[model samples]
Target chain A: MSQFLDFIPKIPVADSVEDAMDLLTDTFAGFFDVIKKSGKFSMEFVTDFLVMIPPVLFILIIAAIAFFATKRKFGLAIFSIVGLLFIYNQGLWEELMNTITLVLFSSVIAVIIGIPLGILMSKSKVAETIIQPLLDFMQTMPGFVYLIPAVAFFGIGVVPGVFASIIFALPPVVRFTNLGIRQVPKELVEAADSYGSTGWQKLYKVELPIARPTIMAGVNQTVLLSLSMVVIASMIGAPGLGRNVLSALQQAKVGNGFVAGISLVILAIIVDRLTQSFNKKRQ
Target chain B: MEKIKIENVSKIFGRHINQALKLVEQNKSKTEILKQTGATIGVYNANFTVNEGEIFVIMGLSGSGKSTLVRLLNRLIEPTSGNIYIDGENISKMNKKQLINVRREKMSMVFQNFGLFPHRTVLANTEFGLEIRGISKEERRLKAEKALNNAGLLPYKDQLPGQLSGGMQQRVGLARALANDPDILLMDEAFSALDPLIRKDMQDELLDLQQKVRKTIIFITHDLNEALRIGDRIALMKDGEIIQIGTGEEILTNPANDYVRTFLEDVDRSKVLTVENAMIRPISLNIDIDGPKVALQRMREEEVSVLLAVNKLREFKGYITADDALEASKKGENSVINYVRTDMPIVPPEMYIQDVLGIISDSKTPLAVVQEEKLVGVLIRGVVIEALSSSDENEGVTENVSIS
Candidate 1:
């Protein structure tokens, strides 16, 4: 066997990877053309109904809920003011709601898939070795890059947009979940084993408890990534504050773009703070 | 009961091909498999049985395979070639499910670092083992409550392990082990990580707890004194083999070899020597109220030099000497008295010559009360030496002998 291995030629690894990339680029070009020819997809129904609820009222309710959960009155005040500005300045209260729904929906789906993948990675070295590189690529790859596949598969709509968003935002959740489970103290794992814990029992009771902080960190990252994806999702005809922001940018509506950007930042802060508060409560 | 045993157990690592190549390159024999693969000889032919309810101690320095030996008994790491029999059944080759059942039903382990679930509250951590056995939540909670109460950690039930002190966390670890009502407990240096004072307290607590439970315990530690304090039988290990296996008295008195002797050489015999074993048979002594002349007359007549000083009530006060009394008589003095008080520590009859010598050196006095704290006989070293050397037929009894 040693003699055989010594005689085997070293394979040309880099050439194969470059060829694969070329193939992907050509496929994406065709995908882009089809989406541009079709009418832009819209989730306007969700927006119109969501917009009917006064933007300030919705923001107040959300901020008030957050303030109670976190016990931070300052958070409520900031969220309320940010909500008022989006309503009065950008005049796209409905668009903000549409974006929030998209972010929340994709985040929920990402968490459902990503957490289990992360946990599996933690348990299995093989899984971690395979999935880790994929996670790195997913996180670094641009959200607009995801749109090419979304457009090809789902034909340019809010469903495609949300699907794309889920893919773009999933890496953090999965990576952190894996990290959290992996970070569980070795002694704790041994203790569980000594107690005769079956594989699943060890995972659920021992691994997960220690992993809560990392999982929450993943959730926070996922939510932020989802929010950032909103603007890219707009180019695929997903209607939201992201779409309004893009339109305002294209028409040189600086004032409107600024307000939309501020609302997105506020949304990111709210999600980040809420998850952190939940983590603190758990600890 | 024969709790566990290992024979010719070797766990080798590295790729099989690599190991083979290394062995061939080194021109080593099959017996040298461990060295070729860089695999540790964790429990090399470790063969010993922990009797039922015995506080069996496995003592060794770190990396001496004491921990590995304990882990092997429970099949935590499968022996490369050996069988362990627990209560007459071969457990070494038990399937995963069987091993799990055995661990759940019969044995529990306490780790040195406590290994408490930092995320779980003290109650939950205590209840973990019971939960793994498929016990109902309510039943587990009740059992956990009882275990915690026993370990004296009930007041901190809701606190997470991170919030507890090291001692309290270890108590939770113990509680978790006890909650399963295991027949045998494996402690791998369980108290070694605590502060010295806390470690002592925990050791006392363990002894007290063991008195009630009477579960067979296999404790691993490097501390010889601790092994002497708690162990009913001890296996002192070096490398991967048991150097000696004996009762505390056996190891303390007749250490198996130079290695075992060196380990016990620094041990304080008073701490280890029991008062019962150290009691001496009192020798008759003649004394007087008026001092020197009468004491000298009795010593000369008896042909023994020294006499124990006593009061009218016949309670021992100290020792007086014939030589001193004779010198005083010549000087026309009423008394010449220099003595070790009776209240001072008596060299137990069971004490080694080394310890007796140490006591003599420290006291800076001619005589010592030899009855340990009992009202046994006073001993003089010269007389004991004379008795030992004169009786050549009892040489084995004296040389390398244990005063049991």
Candidate 2:
């Protein structure tokens, strides 16, 4: 194990840190340019189109979907309507969207990498042995500790913030994916074999499908972790409702701070409900 | 012809140097071998051949290498040293691609658990085998649908596996196997996971399917009764070695050792046996409704205590007795339970006289059904022993036979 540990990539400290931060801003600017100019990645355009519909109508549709999927119609309706009202009252609807976009982007990337790593770990004993300790460290390390190297490389703004969130949020996905795949019943594997499934076919058709519930659970945890990281990421110039809340608290503005906090809670609720609804549909 | 054969299979783990050192240092006895190297022989030089279309059973308790034997046939686990031939192909040396090809083309297995994918619809789970074989999606779907229909799960085709009952899940597993159209079926205690009634139904279903398909099968189970019911040839295993291999009748009559005998002891031989055991010539002209009367008179003339009855069509009715007939005649009553079916394997005429004595000792009227090929007759326990003992002309001989 010690022999294996020596092989991991070491973080370098140099002027390259400043260079990376500049590169992150440039890359983000290029992405925004592509979306704004070409209409290829315009989340703003998508949101504005959505916003054209009456807010009440959109909320009702979302609430109904949530209610059907969760079997909690009353709760979903109350949460959805109240949360929307709070976000508008706090004057943070746009900031809430920006924070949500960060969480969504980071979590999606985390899932893409983490799930495959998990599946690989479950399949190979060596992969499991290698990845498990790293995953453990990632899970246990302080949220503050995640920011240091993140800041060193990408430095101040949404890019480093996304990176830090990924560091914090990624472990649950990988851990649960591996756990889910590993815990798929041994009899199921044999059944797949008996069904004349090739190695790849069995993994896709039998193993992954059977492991869906647990993998979705991993996804749910990743989403929640990403949400938690948003407030922390706010300390480093990643603008969102978290920044307003922090500022209000510093200025001793109790009403403003409470409203900002309530808006954050609403954003969290919307994301949790939406992702959980998608998960329930799949199951 | 043999469809599957395993020869001199010895699966040993650990390096040779340790074994060599232990061989030199310790006494070369069984206990010493077990203690010295901590070497456990999972399958010790085991060998067997399964013929085409034969229902071959490996029956053993846990840790007896039965499951290991099935896995070895499919190369699920590599053997330490051996040769395995499937339809004369040397499977032990097949590479991964070749092995997968063999598994996909020639054989399929059923697990103790149904092993349906919870996330997939029954149709998709069934189609999984075809997907692995690289069949087109449309073709696989059609094939899977047909297989599901055959297994009586077509109605549940769109439902996830969790939506089905245990028995239905097992049917889906069966449909999945059938979808591949493999030549051989390997079942590793497939019915053991089901409720008793469901297990019996599944076993009957398997037998019915086997009748239609005639696929060579290797079934594993710990239950001797199930082994007798399903197996064309059974291999009773102990400690990773086969203790006996024979047909049900052969094993029942001539168990190879005490261990095999222990499994046979509680077996209801009457149920296990067929009409082959109880055929004998009738002794009278009264072959219809008065057959029981002739049987009773014959019992009296022979000085026998009991008589078996049969109807004119030669279907076995029950047994009757002269004492009961006389008592019935006086009382004017007719009851069928008084008669013992001649088709059943009662204690044989040639069995130990002690068993004959025991049978007679308990019943007010004891009957032994006499069989010769398919013909059925009746024999009384007392008359059989009286003949055997009187002909020997030695009273000591009877006691010696009983003691032995």
| Top candidate when judged by DockQ against the true structure | 1
Tens digit of per-residue lDDT, candidate 1, span B1-404: 56655554544334564564455345454447655565555656667777787789999888778888888878776666656888777778788898889889889999999998877789998888899999999999999999999887899999989898899888988989999999999999999999966886788799889889989899999987678777888899887768899987677667789988877765544444333333334433434355577777777777767666655555556666566677778888765444323444455443444356566556544444444233456555455444444323433232323332
Superposed model 1: Cα runs more than 4 Å off: A1-49, A81-89, B17-31, B265-404
Which docking class does model 1 fall in? medium
How closely does chain A match the true chain A in each prediction, as TM-score?
0.80, 0.79
Q: How much is the lDDT of residue B162 in candidate 1?
A: 87
Candidate 2 regions with alpha-carbon error over 4 angstroms: A1-58, B13-34, B145-156, B159-165, B266-404
Please, what are the lDDT tens digits per residue for candidate 1 over residues A1-283? 9989989887878677557656764667676555434423334544666678776676677777677767666765576566556555656666667787788778888999999999889889999999999988887887788887676566666777887989999999999998888888877787888888889999888888788988999998898888889999999888787887899889999987887888777777777777778787777
lDDT of 2 by residue, A1-283 (tens): 9879989877675558667767775768665444334331343444455556666776677678767777666787678877876676656776776676677777998999899999999989999999999988988888978787666555566666777888899998999999998888887787776555676777887788778878988998998898888878887766677778778878999988888887877777777777777777777
In candidate 1, the residue pairs with backbone N, CA or C atoms under 3 Å apart (3 or more residues apart, or in different chains) clash, namely none
The Cα RMSD of model 1 versus the native structure comes to 8.9
CA shift at B343, candidate 1, in angstroms? Answer: 15
